[model samples]
Target: MAELQIAEIPYEDGGIRYRYARRLSEDGTRWIRDGRFTAYHPNGAIASEGTYSDGIEQGLWRDYHDNGRIAAEGQYDRGQESGVWRYWDSDGRDVNG
Candidate 1:
């Protein structure tokens, strides 16, 4: 794993923007903010992910779908969802939308 840092990266296949990425942690480790993350696709589409701090979902958070919809999302709060949370279906569609 690489050290955490704030930097911009390209999508997994260089299709879109992937910013602020950090190394994935161990199973027991919690996601924290050092300004790092990634956005990718399972089949093909957008998916963002990351961590967050100060009640904000920060770092490496991703959102998108394999069918060009919304698949799901990412979290790193070390706790439950709070303050401005969103949900999506398996196809990456927003539930609230």
Candidate 2:
């Protein structure tokens, strides 16, 4: 199996930033973003966490508010959302129904 390779640089835009890492194809022609990923708010606090496979988002994912509170949680299947999803307020109250 190929080992995961991190992006050469971090992505930043609109006060958000994140990094992506993935494995390189045997031909080295394509760099896929696989493994763990995280995004941060402008204040440098973590805004989200998730996993990806073959360049597509997968598995459990969590997004947080700028104040360090979880804003949402759910599962993903190859970048498509799957299973139950929940949302929370900045105060940490579950608002998902």
The candidate maximizing lDDT is: 2
lDDT value, candidate 1, whole model:
0.53
Error of 1 at 41 (Å): 2.5
How does model 2 score by TM-score?
A: 0.82
lDDT of 1 at 92: 48
Candidate 2 lDDT over residue span 1-97, tens digit each = 8987665344464554877678988788988878888888778788899998888999999999999999999999879999999999999999986
CA lDDT, every model vs. true structure: 0.53, 0.85
lDDT of 1 by residue, 8-79 (tens): 556567555645544445553654344534555544355666555432454335466566555544454544
Candidate 1 — number of clashing residue pairs? 21
Strongest candidate by TM-score = 2
The residue-level lDDT of candidate 2 at 18 comes to 76
Name the regions of candidate 1 deviating beyond 4 angstroms.
1-20, 23-33, 51-62, 71-79, 90-97
What's the residue-level lDDT of 51 in candidate 2? 91
